[model samples]
Target chain A: MQKLGDFKLPQFFNYPPYFTLQPVRETREKQVQLWKELILEYCRTQKIFVIGLEEEFPLFSNPEIERSLSHEAREAFVSALVSDGRAEWLDKGHRKCLILWHRIQDWAEIIINFVKENGLEDSVMTVEEIRSGIESRGTELHGLDRIILMRALKLLEHKGKLAIFKGTTADDEGVKFSI
Target chain B: MKEQLATFRSQLEEFARKHRNDIRKNPAFRSQFHEMCAKVGVDPLASNKGLWAELLGIGDFYYELGVQIVEICLATRPHNGGLINLQELCNLLRQKRKHDREAVSEDDCLRAISKLKVMGSGFEVITAGKKKLVRSVPTELKKDHNEILELAQAQGFVAVDEVERRLSWTLGRAIDALDTLLDEGLAMIDDGHEDGKRRYWFPCVSSISSVGADS
Candidate 1:
């Protein structure tokens, strides 16, 4: 059980083949699936929103085994996640990836629940407050990515459950919840 | 003469039936039985409906083995370039038939491969120095190539200088033959030597014992 900053790694992470991209079709598919699950689980637990390909991501390498995923393998696993709608490439070069462990719809639902629980329905709050506000403390919504927070807010606004308008400050935005 | 022939045929049939299990179990005994049949001007593997085929089913056995040998060769051709070690071929065949009771040996694989030679598709067992390699392609080995392969039998590899000195051939001729062998996958190149001379290794002809001794 290798721990990556309090995130417990699975046993198969030490398997050598898991580092190298398998050439065989069936074996590669299973390896990619395992990597996709591990990456998503790691990101969700650590509240990691984006992964830069060129950066040294801890999940991509194992120092004890001296094994690391090649750039091609990293791209392959990330691409698999993108195809399944669990992740999205933020750039054409695929250098950055935004992982969506919870789909946009699910994120919207979580926002609605947080608003109702905090009695913030029909109340106004800055978009940044939903991410770092005292009401969202200790919840998954706390310290969430501003990009994802805005997307979830837009989804809620489209359904007439909330309204997003420019705030008094240029960089700040406000979200008004009707639920 | 007719009476003697009838008696000999009956005797062979009786011998074959008594040692049917030996033929299947012991490769050396099976080859000796084949030799005896050859000595009598009899072909045991001539047809599946023949006397020996009826008594021991050896003909059909080799036929089935021949099909399997082809499959293994073709399956591994991309990796080894149709030149596979005889022992490796047998190992693969055994693995393929692991659930079956019949055990395949190197001798059995050689026999089955020999049967495949009649098809004229270039299936052959060529000895390089001390290694036995199965060549499934129809590429004709020239005299120069044979000589080089023979020279490689001693040290498991041959350098251009050694080939030139021993065979009294020009550098171009030695390179041409070695290059052909390399292209055919019959030899491997080793450029790791400090002397800056390339050593062409024929895996088929190199004896494992000599390699161990060198190491």
Candidate 2:
């Protein structure tokens, strides 16, 4: 019943061993799987795009249980998600990770559908606008991370579904949708 | 004091030379004495003051043997020839409330036998029913047939089994006396191999004889 910023945490989040990396292979596999699901679910709901292994991540510890995952345990869980292609290491140092709760391909498809439904198939919008503008306000695209929005735009661009161009401030990128 | 010391030394030297001649001549008693010392793990003639003191501490070995002989004699009843093994003899001696009572086991017998071997005197274990029994028949009673014999100028035949019954001592003491007697060459043994018949005799001691007839 634990909720963090409107993201409901699973009942096992209170389990102390859930924070500690289990040593036994079978138990650890289940433990890692549960962590993977919880991480993805939390990121998807909270629109969290990046997780820094060395930095504090609210999902890694539960104050109620006074339990926290060690750095090794955090890396193990993240590495499991990375190996499954559900997440990717954002840097070679593996300190930062980009969670793909919805894959780039899935996000590209959603973008295409959103454009068609909005009747803006050939429309142009700034990258930042797509992330937080009025058109995306009620959708999963609203208030999303710019890096993730860029990755999803790039996926669409590769399929000739859209074109990305740099704008004036480096904060604004132009996305022209062919769909 | 010097003149008195010289006199005492001469007397001691003279006595030593006389006993030395007798000790060298009597090989059997010498060997028995040597064997007993060896059995007790003592060096007999080692002039090392402490060793000699320890050996002398035993106090008159032959006298102790004689007392042992008498004790074993009275300990066994006439009937049973109550078979006392080495362990039992040691226990009885140990329980006498004299000296530090060291319990002797079968290993002590082995060590004693090793000493006997060193002294050129040793014992043979008796055999019963084709089995070499652990029971050792002393040399004195080596010729004893375990037969019921008449005591010296006595009335009735001495029953071997009754000796076992009458002796208040443990059965182990009787066997040890028989062992001592066997060692002293007083008893004869049949080894239980001839004609499946059991017999005992005294070849040297006339005091122990058949009750009625010569046979």
Per TM-score, the best of the predicted structures is: 1
True contacts kept of each: 0.00, 0.00
Compute each candidate's TM-score over C-alphas.
0.52, 0.44
Model 1 off-target regions past 4 Å? Answer: A1-179, B153-156, B192-194, B203-215
For all candidates in order, the CA lDDT equals: 0.79, 0.56
Leading candidate by lDDT: 1
- Classify candidate 2 by CAPRI docking class: incorrect
Q: Model 2 Cα displacement at B160 (Å)?
A: 69
lDDT by residue for model 1 (A1-179), tens: 57888888875575444566654454456568778989999999888999998899999888886667779989999999999999888899999999999988899999989988988889999988889989999999999988888888998899999999998887689888899
TM-score: model 1 vs. ground truth: 0.52
Which segments of candidate 2 are over 4 A away from where they belong?
A: B1-215
